[model samples]
Target: MDRSPLWDTFKALPDTFLAYIYAEKTRLAMAEESRHVVNENQQIVAGFHHGYEASDDQYHPGTFQPFMMKGYWIPCSEGKLFQLRQGHCSITRTVEGQDQILYLVHPKSATLFAPLISKYQHTQVDVPALALSSFRTLLIALPAGGTTEFAMVKVSLNEEIGGVRRLLYQKECAASVANSSVLKNKQTEKFTCLEENLSFVPDAHLIDPKEEAVQLSGAGMIHRPVPELFTTQGHYIIPLYALFGINNWPLLNALIEQSQTTPTQFITGALLRPIAEEMVDHIYRQRFYLEFHGQNVLLKLTMDHNDLPAIDFIYRDMGGVNCRLGDVQLHQLPEHLRGHAQYWEPNFIPDAAVIMEGIAKKVLFNLTKVFFKSEPTTRDPEFCCWRAKMTVYGYQENWTLPGADGRTDNHRTRHTPKTFYRYGYFEKIFARELLEVMTRHGIFLNIKRSCPDYDYSFFMDKIGNIDSCNTPCVEFEWFSELVKMTLPHYFQHQDAYSRRKNISVVRP
Candidate 1:
């Protein structure tokens, strides 16, 4: 890895400053002296003779790949070459004799990746090109170990709404977290771990000296201080559609078999129960609710004490966080973080039950039950019974809200006047349905049920001309049947929306 060229360019700039960032790299290289290479039937063969994990045979590279130099460039749609803006340019070459990709970003964009480029060049001994795509002529390369899996490159087709501006917002949000009190100090091991897991995308700058930028379309240089953090890797994290797809059978089968043991279960039980409990606790205690969607929720694997594969979870993309407006005790937080807590406003505070709705729809129904329905091995009554049992267990163990007096709360939160009045009949019915299913599974036989006694006829009687409006509760009703089935029925309703909605997710 060479930094002389980039460093020289940086030094030549008129004004520049260092932005503190964190990077880490770990690797194990085999001894060159012990390496063996052979030509079998004209195919090059090489193998590791000594290592923790040894292989008998591996493909050997027969060609050399060169790094991109100062002059190489990717041409725009109009055939004009993209030039380096400021000192923000990176060169990455493949290891096994592949094409080199050059990333040239505006000075503003560079801040998001500079620390990463420096880390890769220093640690990996080569700035390897990752799976990155750019809509704006200039190529972009994400920092290694960062969540680049969700990176997407698409043509902006919306005529009325602006895509670039939205991306800028995401950038600003990520930068906000990066510059927050918790991250700026970077003195603790937890912060180090967080840095390794998260990737940031800062607001992009339009660098069209000739007035020809792909995303900007000739908009002059603009600077925004927005940034976004992406945690889950798109490839490793199972997509929400994978529930409907057939290719997920293998993983589903494995998880079903593993579910017999509490430590190894992937879908529900021990793995998901505690996390859901944490989410509920966060909402009541910290007023922060996470968007637990399939795209946001990743299925990760980690080894347990016995060295068996067990499920783990990672959360990122703080832009989806739902905040509640109220007084919060911030004296315990760092001096800088205390100020930030006061500045942020609650943007999307839904009925409290919506949080549980999202968790159950995504984790319980979409991720878990869909697999059993799809896979032949797990589609039996036994699997359904298992799923039913786990559903009750999960809610009882995690979703219980304690009253101020401290008992089980006995579903008091669901029946509160404030909740029902604020959210209307839709939320009330949804909450009742959830409670009924849990009760049917024998979750709260001992505690007096607080679910309002409302039957299907009650809903039918109340269903007046209110169906004609374009509001959230009515919109939710269109797929109430699917909700009754405990699935993400809202997705079906979303499909029929008259106006387009942006449900953006990260990708690599």
Candidate 2:
């Protein structure tokens, strides 16, 4: 609970900034606390905790574990260090006498992996040092309400292809130092292989933390913006939006001024492109989906040789990622960690599609709304034009009046243009762009059937239902045609990019 070391790192920042972080953290904690309170009239919503509902009864009930309020300290090979409670289960520790950091997970706190840990009797699991370093660095760079320590020392680009860069950062951890006493006696089973790099971010689980034992967590390489990677020119990382308090408007303005690019170009190229590309690549190659909302995503801005802003993204919180199981080789995973249903999905396309929708609605759409100064909902001329287009495109039908017998009669039709305006121009545009991106990546939209036939009745029933509307159908059809026209060229470009960088082709 002693966060002095972490707080000291932010000494360069103003006290008001620290106060903002504290206020934000307190507000978030309060909000989470309120959400966890279930009234007597409310039903016990299963799997609501951390957005995961247990498919099996053996796991902890949904009513338990209220927002990771508890933090535990573990005795490791080096010694006992203070646990820095993050928003979730993971914590960071500084390695003494070395410039390194280790990310450790309290397995019990991670609901997804808790069953596996209990079944295997594992003591502790090691998160990727690089990933942890990246996570820690990102936390410092974009100080949210959680733990803050300058864990990352330096970051360097491991590889770069087609403007996307693979970053590597170093941090200091106590476990990274070799224990001569344990090494000489050959009792190294309790020590983790700190140097092993693997793909896939794991939900680390542990048992009996007081015991002196360390186990390697499920391993895999994760790509994207994380932690501390800086250039000699002092390039810094900032979140697309703050976790609390301030907004990204000023930052966006500064970035636009510095890059000398219009807001549209910067947003489309720097923000949307990276996110869409990463999502598509992850689904296609890695067989996983990321929650690329504002908080989980960060922007790495630096000046290029031409003084234009070179933008990259860093994604954190691997525990929330959903993996596709059917295509993923489970045999490649550790024996103990195999067959967990929480993270892996047999049919993952729907989940991935939903995540894409979230990015559009939660991240891009809101961002555009902020940038354009557009109203939340508009019933203006543009909206009317969009509705007309939807009707012409067969996504909406002419309104039919209800008959005296309380049935919809086809004979009597009325075109009463209802003032139902939930989407603005920017929202529609972003939705269409998202569909285009999905189409390019071979992900076509498949709207579920709320009614047997998706007809006028369906549209009427879902008039105000933003989540399920006919908008996607219209956009999908439009983009599908466009993609069809450019199918050959798209494949050619994709193949060329793959050939240009083989590693980038297969990486997330």
Candidate 3:
């Protein structure tokens, strides 16, 4: 018998290389098992079959009910494939005990998504290829490099969605990513740049031949699998969101503290400062906006001696990105980004002030506040607090004031007095306790305390000076009141609300 090509290659290589090939073969076998189509009618892929429970008794109250629905497994540039839903609803049945519940997907959502997916499949939308209708089925390409474990693990996570809670969690996260994208900074490449976040949608044409409306299955709908499984260089790196969310706080903290120095050093020295500086400079100097809220950010913790957390700062959705294209040097930007600017609708150009406000809202309020407030106990509350505090203050000193006067960059357009009047409230109380907390932490032992001298009154005056004819006093009051509700108090209110809701019976 003739020797196989793989065998011939193996024989020509060193003996050590055979072990790698053997491992590759093993991985391919597992992937083949996973991508196998279990139910031809439903297009149910295999491997996930192990997680399926035949009886409702086996499911957690929090798990989405298990049922087979029409879906597709779209392949990434890396050999991995993610299952996406077709014809609107991924889950097609009502819950067993709940008669009021009809379906997981709304009719309106499916109606809107169907045409979008079809258009992507047939036409070039300048969007990610996942929008295409033709990308279907978990096709396992043999001998593909890298461990299939992450892809399989993702599949398992999808499989374990057996309760309503799981469904809701997925829905909420997806919605958040979608909504946050609209708030991203749209500034051109002269001063700011961002990663485009994209989500998976089922090509109904490929997955649903009958073109029937997707019904809610007690078995939940499959969502687009995040392609973050593979890095830009094609390496696999797990995101910190998974560890933090999966109740692996210990692992996260341990990784943070693994170095000889404190968690603050690891965060500040290795990860935080560089990114913070870049963001602040761009926002303040160029008036380019961003929404780097934690969910959109991914952190990769190394188990090696280096103790590095490789931060993949991804801004996936483009809808919220606000920027002044006229101020940007478009030629300096890469090709795809150039396409983004060229393809953008002409009317969507936001005012310079609006982009600055977006930075304060998304980056400062949403990212910094939420992180420090929610996970205060994750590391030493002191460390998280300082890091968060410093981040806010650094932005103000380095970017905010400088950008107001065009001091950050000579080429950048400075914020006009009118623009300052609109956005001054943000500068006034940004990270309200940051300076006070820094003093207490002794982080300012050598540095002079300048918070007292900072002109809070000027910003306050700007706020009051706004003409009430166009900008209502009520609107300014609402903004002030909203900012006053700091993250800690906001979360406290949420906890109280949740406690009240969770109390099934109360005695009078």
The lDDT values for all models are 0.30, 0.35, 0.30
Across 194-237, the per-residue lDDT of candidate 1 in tens digits comes to 12112122112323223223233322111111113223222122
User: What is the per-residue lDDT of model 2 for residues 99-188, given as tens digits with 9 covering 90 to 100?
Assistant: 212322222234433433454333343221211222112222322377432222222222332233322211112111111111122222
Tell me the deviation in Å of residue 217 in model 1.
17
Best model per TM-score: 2
Q: What's the count of clashing pairs in each model shown?
A: 15, 21, 30
TM-score of each: 0.38, 0.43, 0.34
Using TM-score as the measure, name the better of candidate 1 and candidate 3.
1
Consecutive 10-residue window with the lowest summed lDDT within model 2: 29-38
By lDDT rank, best first, the candidates go 2, 1, 3
Which ten residues in a row are the worst by lDDT in model 1? 18-27
- Order the candidate numbers by TM-score, best to worst: 2, 1, 3
Q: Could you give me the TM-score of model 1 versus the true structure? A: 0.38
Instruction: Give the best candidate by lDDT.
Output: 2
TM-score preference between candidates 2 and 3, better one: 2
